[model samples]
Target chain A: MDIEALRQQYLQQLQTEEAAAPPPVTPEAVAQYVASDGRDDVKICQMIASLPLDRETFETSVRALLDIAADKSVGAVARLAALRQLGSAEFRAARFGPFHAEYIDLLRTLATDEDVEVRTAALERLTLTADPHALKLLSDGLQKVGDALVPAAKAVQLLARDDHGSALPIFRTLATEAKGQVREEALRALATDVKSAPLFERLAANKDEKTALRHIAAVNLKNISPPRFAKVARKLVLDENEDDKLRAAAVSAITHTPAVAEKVVTRRFATAVKKLRATTRSGALKSSIGRFSKVFGEG
Target chain B: MVNVSVKFPSYDSQGRAFVTWRPVEVKLTLAGAPAGASNVPVTVSAKSSAGGGALAFATTLTHLGTPSINLNLPANGAPVSVWVGGLYPKASASYGDVVLEVRAAAGNQLLGSQALMVRVRKNADDLTAAERDRFLSALATLNGSGTGRYTSFRDMHVGGPPDLEAHGGPGFLPWHRAYLLDFERELQAIDASVSLPYWRFDKAAPNLFSRAFIGLPDSLNRVQFSAGHPLLGWVAFGAAGIQRGRGVGPTTVPALFSEAQTLNTGGSLHASYSTFRNMQGNPHGSAHMSHGSGWITSPPTAPRDPVFFLLHCNVDRLWAKWQWAAKLHDPADPRSFTPAAGFPPGHRLNDALWPWCGPLAAPRPTTAPGGTLAASPMTAAPGLSPKCRDMIDYLGTVAAAHQAFAYDDVPFQK
Candidate 1:
């Protein structure tokens, strides 16, 4: 007997049955299926997603999903399904009122779980809570050391979206301290917040900062205020002692705004090119100058 | 029966005397001697060459400022004992045969003699199959004694202390170095041939979780000590119990630390308390927190896990490498003179490491107001204060620490 073939046939048959019957689409029915003995997480998740749940039933459905998500005895796939359902916009909008704290607590615990998928799911779900505890949870997760870091970075993005000022400290720390994609995400998150302009300006101007961090700061600074950033960018481009990568960041940032580009290019083009020739003697800086001239309509 | 033999680790791999172990003691056992042997005066002498040549270095063994003492024999002819101490190799001598002679008190008659060979080599790594087996055997002996005996001692010392003192401050690296040495001494007592093997995480070796070392996770996605493995039945000293937790996903090693970041400056010993200490803590603390869950995840109870020692051994190795390659020196600050709050008087560079007091010891724990332990000295180890010296003496001892061993790979930045 070929057990693999038999299993595939059985799965196809179940899919056919699922298509014909299409599981009930009521909130009570979703909750019932979630709590039922049958361990078909995919079918249950599909039913919950399709349901047009009212606020009262949506709350009830969230309670049932929380139970599955928090249960370590349940398979990871099943728990992840419950978490995704809870993270959905319709379910998140339903007020838990008295159960809000309990719901947040469940998500916080799952955020630190040993399983990576569960931790990712919990982080995604917490982004919707908008509670102060959710912010604290995201901040604490950012400080964690290992695999959860990438997911934590994602959570920071969500938190920054909801309340930029509150997530500023974490963004600043990540911008300077973190490496690779995590750092990029943090810089992007900081740039998205208009309030982070001063911090970005300080980071861009600091000579002791890592070149990568300074570059990100310059790029992000342009997003908040191009004309203000142009002054810092122009200084970086003209400073002979500055790192080449940093000068490139300044050039790239300054070229983005037409007004700022026209003024800085017309003012510093020749001196900047001569400095590049005397110090680096590379075509790289010359090309940047030519690019800036074209943007300023003086090429 | 008359037996004369060199110790189990007669010669280290490089064929030199072990560095940290000084004055390698030679044991002499005598049986069926004459009646007056009980009162016989004996003198033990060592010479550099095999046949009674001039002594290359000092051959005298002394205790309490007195020259070689007489051997005492039981009337029943049970073996009389004479310990030959101070057998370290000279600076220029890579390998030499030391001939030890025992002469009679009156006529200078030869009673017994033996020639011993001494050797030194780099520290052990788990990559070698035999080294791994030896390590597991030593760990089994240490672990079998139960977590309460050893792990509890570490937990109490670090967790109870002048709180921030042992960690997040200047004493972090030095204190942990002393701790690993103390634990290594215990392991040597269990098996003289055993040395603490470091885990070179920079190599990104995937076999660290092999059954020969800490086994990989089981089918349930749980990391348990393998069934029938030496550490399988071992119980945890902390609340985490005996269960092991294996790290998953990307390796935490690269994220937690980079050699470039840790050894950035000829790190100052006199700078702010956070200067070198906090820099070391970046990777050190991150590794502890990144192990996911289990005893290794938390600072206070981390010693309960067997993996903690291997992780710390690598950290100690890095410090040794930094001291050597960077030519960085420890601070001679007089203000760094205060001792650990609860432990003893040894926080200064010249001070002897308290608790494990002996000659050639590491420095004492430095003071940090909030980091100091709150326990009374009376409740701690007795006579601990007297055993410690000032920082100067402590540095002198640790300076020679690598004389007994070296790292297989020093990760020096070009």
Candidate 2:
């Protein structure tokens, strides 16, 4: 037979089998499908979605999914499906009130699963709980690498909505050390709270830190407290030993703070320009100075 | 009257024959042959009871040419000698008694026959300690040789521009696969009994870095061989010098090898092309980054450090394990490349790897002057393409590359 005809026949066979398969009636049957080794994940997920979410069935199904999610031997895809099932609103609304601690514990363990998808699924489930314990779990997951780090950092952001103070140290460490989007998320998280000012000040003043991190800290600090950030920004702009990149960041930070005095900003620019003159008259340096002046509304 | 004797290392201590697709020299000596036997045509044929079945991808004699040799039969008991070589097994060939038959052309009479019980096993880490020692000794011979072949392998990494087509995309795994096979082939040519050993980084094997094996550099800050080491005379090719295990702060290695990252990145067949590539690239790059600086950290100069081979072997082992766990083969799609901007020309499933010329051309030197230190332009070693091959051909070469060897710790399907 030709390839296309064979494919058609195979599809017909699958459709017949799928049509013949009975819908899972009891919670035990659904749990069996969920925990079945090497079964099709999409089919399992579809079955889960079709199951009636009556109170007793919902509790039984939550227990089964939790068991699968906790079983490290299960394949990551299957575990992820289980985690997603547990996170569904129906499951949360049905059993999470009575079993909140057990659910939180399961999520906390899964948040560090060796599989990224499993960890991500657990973190997603944790977010749905809106429990304060998730804040600690999300903060701990920041040290994770690869794709999991992003979600963990994001969970911190979501949790920050309720508890910004708890996420401050986690955001500070991530802002200084994390790269790429995770760092970006942490910076965004820190900017939401005025309490982040002390950490931001330390990060901004850390000359040894990456210029991007220092810049992010300075920018966020300005957003948190303009008057205090303006003083720090002025000191950074006048520091001759500071990198030109960070100095430029300081200038941008000050420009955004309308509360800073124009005279103080002008004085900082004059000191920077004088330092640039002493170093070299290169076109790059001259342009940087010009750009700084422009940001401060001085020609 | 004719007398024939066949000589070769037919089996390991475990009673397995020398592996297939690796060169094994069969020496022949004729004594007391009839006079006027000069320039006699001799032919050798080999057969195996295990291979050549309907489902076999490699036959018993896939690449084994009709072994023909011209021999002058000795007169009055004087010895006549000829060597019959260039024999390799097919990739899909299985364990069996490989029977080699020799015949004289004039009368087509049987001159001699020999049979070897050959069995292909996993990589060297699975070998017995005695077997491993022999393998290490053979590797040392290859490393110590003046043959520009070893230097050429290192130079291939160093001589090219920083972005040579070997890395940073879907081709990274395939390119390294071909390169490792080439290195293995060279080692086998020296001694067919030897195979590349994998270093399991997840498990601490500090002994691998000792002077007895892949000798450590004098200091982490310096990338030179330690004093009294076998590779002390070895010179750095394109690298500034060797630097390893220095300045790699504590966290990177642990972070890179975190269980969640390794499995998530490597364990899924459903991963997007960029996701899988990035996942593989993360640990691969982090391992390089964690090895301190100098050769290990630099793309163009990594191969100058001997540790690079073992590290890559571990990476390859991980790929193999991943494939087995996920039940996924490499994506056959022609468009499987990284989606990131500014990446060098992405490779398709059939794209030719740059700098690795096919079996004909010499490896291209790094664009930078003084990158290569070979006394003369080095040619591609036998069974290796001088030009980089397309992914299909590379897959073909290494499809069963791991068949002849297995890792002790890797959980790959048998």
Candidate 3:
């Protein structure tokens, strides 16, 4: 529901506290409080949920929760809750259509939040409310996460959700520069879905990528759904002297799409099959063919 | 061969009312002045103003196998002129109007300035106001409307949808171009002014609808209209149509993709605001010079304009371009975007000032206070104040010196 409605509902529930004569504070009250539909109520609930108070003697617990949310350390969640609470209302109130007016400071801070979750949430909210500012912030913040490829990758994913393919720069940074899981995740993230299609396109387009990364991207193309994969796969399969593993990977990837399978299963498929046929040890080829056969539901 | 009736405004010399014939459907066709019949031979060319310039067939009849040459016009409206005799040998007596011009790789050149005039039939004004409104809404939706995607300015999605669908979304250029045309046509349907004073972004901004048209710097109390013009609207919608007095502006490379990059990264604003409000650095809300192309030249429209789609496509393309261009090499590489960066830090979904910099109310940590320091902030390079800071920053810090993201900004030239 919209933030105003949620807030009013939460506040109304809180007002009922006095009418009930205020029984011993219990987890129910705390849960109810956090569950309150409003941002303030949610903030209160999150604060209370993390406390160690018993219902009968809950005064101290509620107080502590409020204090902590107020505290700098717990502020991220507090801000998140507040933003979540009020965001809907703010969005509804904005006068600009096809545009949004900005309220300055709040945006600047949210754009550069310290907590990744809070930052992400803030970006999402900003995307709706203060589009121009949000876009500027995103462009500004791409370099904020260095070496931290997971966060960087996450950032890229978020960017991709916005159709900001420019985030590819960050993805590229993570794909090559990040260590271990970060790099792998970046590469995987880059290959998955139509949004990541650009990443795969780059992989196919770039002649300079590390041979292994290119191979992985080609393999990852296998997981994509339908016509999009087919079009991209066809392009990859046609490139001359494509790495053997990559070519096999392209062949393997094509099996996922029926259209691609139908097209590749012909002379293209035979050529790839023949290439595999030429291999002596054929370790990669064997796996690719195995995967291909399984995907095509071949006997 | 099947014969087709030909209609025209006039006939050619020798009292010949020639309606040259060619295949209607099939690609196979061969009939034009034979290969080498033109020693400085004068040529004739014809075209239909209707039918989007579909190729008209040309054929020649003769005693000796009727030497005929096929003239292929890409699409027809008006045929170009050129003299033929200087290039071909005039061996045949019945050269016909399809005279030979100098052969070139570009296309078949017509040999003469011979003119064929035909009063083209006018298309009926078909779009209604409701249709126009729907078109506007649809255009806005296509241009700026999206959930997480922020394609332009006026696309703030704080709590609810950017309202782009409610108003008009981002398809400002095409929607309006189509809209104005339809409006003119609508009026024409009622027998109103059929002559629409086209906005020549080249000569000057078409400030015809003055009252409704506001320009940049709303504080100026000025309208984009020609001050004395009566047809233009008088109401002001803020500084929407201010900057007038136009000249041919520099060609700009569309940066929709780059714009998308910043919007996405910052989580600051939606696409609408990014496009309109910040047409030039988010200063004057949704007011600025509307971009356009010339008459002879193909006016770039959204989707049709490579700038439009390419920016989005390349935003897509770059993701691909990036995989190979550079992978994250090191933490300080400046190309990295990590989760730890704390994107969307506080969730001020409705806050108009998104992609905000600074802290939320008390307790919200503005900067990533973790162990790692945020890398050096990128800035616009010397003398290069890109309207979108994100592009400038990225170009300065990450992109090579030679790599530049092209965008349209108000030309500072007087």
Candidate 4:
């Protein structure tokens, strides 16, 4: 029961009124707009459950929503709305769970719909099930830049979820050839594969590289190879000439890597930190000291 | 009358319960117990000071211990200590609720009673059934189908007129801190035992996304809750329900960066506010993007979905943990903060945050959403016109700044 139900239970009642009821909704009023042939699929979806009519009308309304989802001529908004209404708690609870297989079939068909929204929504829903069917669609789409169902980057992102782990070639190609969100996501996917450790090291160490990508490389280096991460991190933290922000990331990596932090960050390193604190004007360099101070017993 | 005072060593200066899950040490000193009342057995228990079910399971202690305990009050009247460790996750709405009462075990003679101040924000997954229901009902009431006070919050995040001050800058973390606090305080105003619960998007949160809870999504990405779900009456701009679903990204669970990855966005063990703030692109931006087609995919339309609060709460939690771990509270310390040079007005350290401030001219959003900041029953450090600098020391660690809220995982430094 809600807090409101607790009211008036005692002589010293803590009575609070219930919130005002939402203005009445007339599902029937909206259902009148639907055509028997489901040409008005959008309106049919809006009031599918609360039809107030016989079971046949409700069933027809349900079928209309599903039909709209598959009908390419209906376009994105109406099609997506139909799928949404069919997947809603009301419809799902109305024994729509049995349509699970049928729903997947509809999604499989829509995954390659001409409209980006339709295609993307289909792929996203399919990705949730880790369905093998999406694997081929995403993979085949990856090889083509023009006729692709979705952008190569989005395809790589969704494909990275594959249970088969078969997207490494695609990830490598995109990581090298792509830019922006695509390359970034591809690099993230590549980081998990040990085979790409060397690439991570090169990017992490290259000073001329974009700081964002370098940061990703520097962090993943710890997991890829602890000794290598320590060596790179130690050099960066001590490099007073380096960008203070990047140096902060280096200091962070060593301090957080328990396995190598103690071995690499010795008493001499503590002296260096103290000296750096006294001389370095970089706030990022100074800010990186707190966690290091605690772990190494430096005040 | 038997006299006694309760002191929870773990409580703050305001004497409120900060950690609800753990056994907070409560010590009682017998001040004016009659001399005739010598070494005798007494029962200690917790009840609602205002009388209600808000404190329902409060007496249910951990380790199979009963709510009321039988302990002997020594003749010497030395202070007696008892651990108040119950899994009571709800926070009191008003000043507070839970009160401690002592009675003579024999004749059931009354002693003294004191209210236990509880006001804590908790994890959504950790909430008990009763606590979850209270939070949901209070949220529904506050929304009142989009016509209630929640519109103020939904409007605050649209981020157009004020130069998007709340995002893409140093103020993002601090601004959202105030936003979530204001929203949680409103919920508490409706029912004291309700604090906003956060969704740990890094983890697979079954409880948070279930139909019985925040609601699951349909095929079209429309969120669906079970029938009679309190959130059913949810309305935004007069429209009902929320629009959200899994993104076209890989897997639902790992699509966004994990907390470990996010905490070290610099790809190291830790990072500075300057570095970690870059998460605006990954986990933070990616988390929003992972919702696919929904109001949450972008800032201007984000808060329309109630999950926006939960999402931001976790973001704030990360900052809190980072601040705590690195001792990054002192705004005076140069190492504590470094906004990009020429960061927008509100993003600067001492500048007043908007929506919380009184209306202003062209530079500010043409319309302020919630009036001034909502007052917290706990503390007044973060005033109505809070500045970016005020939010840094949230735990009141080094500064007696603001202890308005506490997370289950982040312990109070005090």
Candidate 5:
């Protein structure tokens, strides 16, 4: 088949009937437009699967084809076909370079699509292109996020791995006003690795919150470091005369977590024992001591 | 604002000098209250915001009934104030330290204060000798031999005539209150210093319950309960029903009458001397009601607050009073253990009957319609049985017996 010639012919057919755009030349036209093998079965499958994603009902077709491609283990060609369905082919161009430059808009649209999978794909493609501007687009898309902000926040969290500074604000806002269940989940999203330490400190200082909130914050902070997290824990646990219940909570929070237990366990446990002995008339302090001892001993 | 001096008697306990107080003489003024002051109606709240806090009771003060607020003490002493809270009808922020004062209406007036600080302090401890005796007296009344069953009550459920229709149900709230009051009156007549501290279970429980259930204390030590612990579940369900179906508070947060209930009764520590258990436990004793009416077996903690000793005094006293009231109604009345509602009609014999019910549930025991014992103006126990004075005398007799047992134990020859 004269594949390139047929493609030109369809392009002219579409232009000739400008008002009607010739209703997206059928599957036959599509195969002709992209140039397919008439004989080799594997080549025929690849040709059928590699159809452009910008034709009429291309999104719907591309979605169904992608499902098939995924099930059948289609490779880079299917990824390219899926990328072309985007409003801008920015992701595709980034994946394949200026060879597919005419499809830049489709990729750009995918970069900002509400679908988490689409946005993630676009970001992954941008990573390959070494495009500094694509990173800005990811950051900009995050900036104006609406209710989709939860997924947006998750994506930004990943973005933080490379560009941590830009995603920090979104993480902070979510950590603050999100509902109790939401705040709990957001903690995991925002407090990955060692970078979540400062956010933990900010949450710890929020007095308007209930003891449980403060308790969780102290825990997250302790997860990040040694003497520093231990120091904050010490202030709370060693105070001796604070709300004993709250103090005990702070002690348990700071002493038991995975990261800082080794560094501060002995000191924190000893201090907790001493303070509990000195102040608690209710025997709660001593009970707290046993808890710390177990955690430190186990650790 | 009317400023009045409310005085309470100062007493010595184990070398510690303590004075008690109650909030009364509340003056209603809209001038300095929070926003919507004019729109707000007068509110009267008597509460204790102590370490183990609770709202004692609340009611609108319609008007000043008397200049002297009478309080009762254990033993036969004059009714006097341990502490008192009152409003200053004539004092204001503009008046510069001219606060209202509360003082003992009688006696040396050793305890007197015009400041809210002193009132709060006095109300905080919740223990006193008078309170102890009051509870003791109630126990004595209910447990007295001649007056010892549920039907001993000849009067209305409360102060009205005894009606078989009402039975002992919610209508018994006021009835129980009156019974407690009668017991309180008797305690006062014995020792005027004794007074009853009304408890508001709502405010006192928040911190306690939060610590017990939500916050981590020790799981065993925590009052770690939900709306599922059978008895408490009933209370929660009942209170919730009252609120939702009947427009009560959104939450069925019960008030804590005791500090001990919160701190001690957990896994690690067994403090049973707390007020929460005592107050919550009272209604539980009614077999006619639910068995676990939430009555506590003991105090949450030991060496309980001096207040606990007094609170129990009234509790024990009320039990005694109930016994006396029940017995006075029918000496042969055996319906004590029967559920308020008997078995299905036409069943001549009760499916379940107390030991005494076999005798009372017969035509022989049912007095004629106009018979003297049946239609007598007085519903008290027979003169041959026990008079009120005889009952009091018997209580003293029991006291003597207990004292003798404590002092004179026989030694076994080894």
Candidate 6:
């Protein structure tokens, strides 16, 4: 972060060019590079990159990027290049405090930059911060369909991270109203929401629905209401036309609640699985049933 | 040069005095006293100067239930051994935050005084009001309202590249051991006296489930933290406040395996490491699920709420207690730990654990979220990129095995 020290170090490195030593990264001095108007940006970037950092300065390296990155007058390429350094592999170990006021202020300012590339980059970073502003933007984007800062599925996934209290209302609406991944994501986040028992019931039993979604619905239903899950799991296992994987997942969820699994898993359920396994040849499903049979003590 | 100094008959491998929230005993000794000094009548007392801990004198270690007590030292200059206890400090304390000063005097004639450096990770319910406050303050500060190092820790779990290295395999226990260590080290960095407290899921920890503590959620599963509680502003994944369900309260045991049942998992006291790690499901997963439903139940989202650490700490403790009972700290023994063979790359006994493993391709999760495993000032058993084996033999039961931290119940043995 100390440009003066970097200048001094650059000079020292140039002076000690021993035979085995690699060439100095860039002859362009740091001071001139910072002051230049794009004539020496590449060399300057390389020169700054060459400096070594210990644990103490690792954090400062992140801070230093803020100055170069926030300079609007600077070329977009140079600013973005500086910002991207924060994401470097080694910087993953950097101890920079991401919540520092200056760093946050920089992110807020850039979230709406004129350039779309920079704007999207900043928006993604802001979303990860879990900032309320990012939440609103993401929420609005999901509601308005095409007018989104991020994809609806991605938005659902990010919204799911809210732990459901804040996202519950949106998810409850999406669980029934949204389509495909967004619907599945919304339904998945509601795995613990007891209020959605009916939705879980409807989806878990809808033979026409995709097995993946139905399986998730079954798990969600099982977690919230084990008895309800028991009722559903028993029925799913007996239905010869039901998806094999869903049947397997149904049995898996039942075993999670042994008390419920006990009442629901009867001689009839065992007979049903044996009958289904006879007609089923899918290796994964056959394997799942085998495991289920052992769990139910029918092995 | 007859001065007084505080000493622990027990010490860390470094000869330093370290202790958990559980009581550890210490003694008073005289230095440079004349050879014939006998029946040296002196009054002795101890107190935490920084106000996060307390001291008391008791005849036996079990009598540490009270905040203050009287000690009966010998009538000589000889070293008298006694209990050195913690949890007297106020809440919001950190590691090394409690500097206990033990002083001796002959009726106001100051003979000598010595300061003992100590830290404690106490049960959440047993924490003094001051101790609890310190823990919350330090944790809230670490969270920094959702943008601090805590976020990085939250990311390390749940989702990562190619695999979920922290769960469902032989690596589960050790992976979380190192994970909690990294997190606790970071918390300590915020406040030295702040050690991660364990949430004994088998017991009803009402204080922990309170809104004032980890925050009890409302009817909608929205955590209702007490007014101005540090976590009131908590945010993760763009959600403000914790979205935890009103789970089974501290009263009425949730469906979790007791420590005894969990330790005696394989129909025997000393089960193989593979059989023992099944704890990842019940007590581990079941404890997470016992909350009815919340981020804690799912692997990827569990770390969002701070309770995740405490829940896992008790899990780790169960493992530690089992290790102690089975004498299975030596990883070289096949029973000590399951071999990494046939498991994922990072799951290998000697493979560096992820995130701490830095950036490696395939088999291991990409983009290690929390840099390296934190180095402890106490000892250096687990390095920057610690291997799964490094987390085993936690107390160094095997000679020269690296040691990281200690538990109040699990004593440090040479």
Give per-residue lDDT, candidate 3, residue A209.
74
Flag the better candidate by lDDT, 1 or 3. 1
Two-chain complex of model 1, DockQ on C-alpha atoms against the true structure: 0.01
When summed lDDT is taken over every stretch of 10 residues in candidate 3 chain A, the lowest stretch is: A90-99
- Please tell me which model should have the higher DockQ, number 4 or number 5: 4
For all predicted structures, in order, the TM-scores are 0.39, 0.37, 0.26, 0.50, 0.23, 0.50
Q: How many backbone clashes does candidate 6 have?
A: 23
lDDT of 2 by residue, B202-273 (tens): 444555655444545443133332222323223333111233544233122221343234434222232444
Q: Rank the candidates by lDDT, best first.
A: 4, 6, 2, 1, 5, 3
The parts of candidate 3 lying over 4 Å away from their true place are A1-75, A85-105, A114-116, A127-150, A159-174, A181-216, A219-259, A267-299, B1-414
Instruction: Give the per-residue lDDT digits (tens) of candidate 3, residues A1-299.
Output: 13234334433443353233212234445545554455464445344322322212333433333333333444465545433323211211222221123333454455566666555555554442225656555545557633221254344433433333445566667776786545654565454345565666567546777655664454344334334446656665555555555554455445433445664566545565555545524455454455455434442
lDDT of 3 by residue, B213-274 (tens): 22222211122321111111111111011122121123332211232222222232222322
lDDT on C-alpha atoms for all candidate structures: 0.48, 0.48, 0.30, 0.62, 0.31, 0.61
CA lDDT, candidate 4, residue B269: 32
User: For model 4, what share of native contacts is present?
Assistant: 0.01
Q: What is the lDDT of residue B364 in candidate 6?
A: 61
* Model 5 misplacement above 4 A: A1-109, A113-135, A145-155, A163-199, A210-220, A223-225, A235-292, A295-299, B1-414
Model 6 C-alpha lDDT per residue in residues B1-414, reported as the tens digit of each score: 555566765544444555443344567666666666654444555445554445444545532434544343344556766654444333224344445544344444455544444464557777766567667766755664355477788888854442257763577788889888888888766555567788888789888878668877654455665533545435465444455545567584764456655665223463688767656544565576566445664556677778988888888888886776666788788898876587766667887788887877864665767677876665565778888888887755464433445554554332
TM-score of 4: 0.50
On residues B349-382, what C-alpha lDDT tens digit does candidate 5 reach at each position?
Answer: 1221111122234422332111121111111212
DockQ of each candidate, alpha-carbon based: 0.01, 0.01, 0.01, 0.01, 0.01, 0.01
Model 1, range A110-197, lDDT digits (tens) per residue?
Answer: 8778787777556544543345655665666666633333355566554553433676777778776787656755775676556777
Residues B181-255, model 4: lDDT tens digits: 888878877666677888887777777778768877665455766533556435564333566765432224634
lDDT minimum window of 10 residues, candidate 4 chain B: B52-61
Q: For candidate 6, give the lDDT of residue B399.
A: 49
